[model samples]
Target: MTRTLVDPYSVPDELRPYLQEVVQRTHALCGSDLVSVIAVGSVALGDYRHGRSDVDVTVVVDGTAPGPVVPELAAALAHPALPCPAAGLELVVYDRNFTARPSGEAGYLLDINTGPLLPERASVDPSESPAFWYVIDRSVALQAGRVLYGRPAREVIAEPARADVLTALRASVREHSSGEGHLADNRVLNGCRSVQFCRTGRWQAKRRAAEAVAASEERFRPLLRAALHSYERPSRTAATTLPTTDVHTFLAWVAERVDESSDADRRG
Candidate 1:
């Protein structure tokens, strides 16, 4: 749906008027016919820090006419007043065809149908799936941040979801597993973060998945022995590769099982 959390009064003094002016100018330029324009990412979440964090904005329009509006909106945001001094602005344009889809993370969705502004939705409850953990984990650490629209940061941080929010963490670990070396290293790091969140019940499934990953390690002697009990040799040469696609897929499947079990435990 269309959600806008603009609070012009909350912007910093030096940046306040400029942002409001830009919004006004953009509205005038586009005849204000678009759907909603809300601030998201680090800034909207109030975790932004200066000299870091871009001015993240989302302008949801009515039709498929985003192509025509891009240049106008960009010019307005980048005008001399703001000049996009810091991390620059990320602009996303979503039309009616776009629907909120769950982001594999608890209650979160991929949000934008297209563009570079695929920032996660800020949930009211920190425990909701697809909460800001992805952003908290990946987005450049905010030196400072402020809301320029809709709801207050506290409000957004208080809403709860149907399930704990860590499911997305597990999904991210599985989905982005192709690269090796440093990329593989990043995946492992993210996997570790997922584990941390999961351990807190924010992401129950992810915690279990992390446990499974830890258990597979050569250092976890007893767990490895247990794994060896049920392990069966695959009939192919490709099966033994540590970083193979098959291995990742298998890990993801196992992770899903772990998540399911965690859910069952909660139910019981």
Candidate 2:
């Protein structure tokens, strides 16, 4: 059953039609089991630069849905004509029951990832990566997440503990800090945003966060500027101009700062 596709609300024009189809398809396939479809990450925040950001989403399903729903949604999303914009689609689907009681459960039924790094894949089991938790946490799923169907975003996801968010941020910094080339730029800019969020309980768009931190902090200006440039031209490593050694140094510094902040948060 193919659901009709219409322009989705609050979605960027580039991916709206495609995402609309994807969401509708999921609805048709899952029927009564479907709970909600949500847009998250850069797309939800309105900072999705064409050719640079991936379309990220979260779909919720009632617990009674059959186990095969994972693969079904993956197949529903893989439209040949509507190829994933930059970096492909990063999607996660959760069971309504699991989300309602997030403390003990692994929080998702399907984790579908497809992009430059790997072919389209869907895992029925939860991922060990901090990113999985990053999405499940309220920061991405509730604060920035936009509902495409069903319940309101806040009702679909639980408000995560502050400690959980801090833990995820620290782990993300540790993992991304080792990246080089274009990834180095991502690590730097994302580090600034994560740090800013940790310091002040507010979340801002990546480039805006970098600009705000650079303007007030002077020391991070050059690196943040280079990161913003690299973010725009992700394919051109040379355009970043910052040496690999410098990127590593900056990453290490950012990691240390995040650790210190996390420790302080825990203590306080």
**Most accurate candidate by lDDT:** 2
Off by over 4 Å in 2: 1-9, 79-82, 102-106, 115-118, 131-138, 180-182, 234-241
Q: Name the candidate that leads on TM-score.
A: 2
Cα displacement (angstroms), candidate 1, residue 63, comes to: 1.7
Could you give candidate 2's per-residue lDDT for residues 144-263 as a string of tens digits?
Answer: 877777776688687666666666777776677656323667777787778677778766778888887788777667878888888888443344555677667766776777688778
lDDT, residue 138, model 2: 45
Q: How close is candidate 2 to the true structure, as a TM-score?
A: 0.87
TM-score of each: 0.43, 0.87
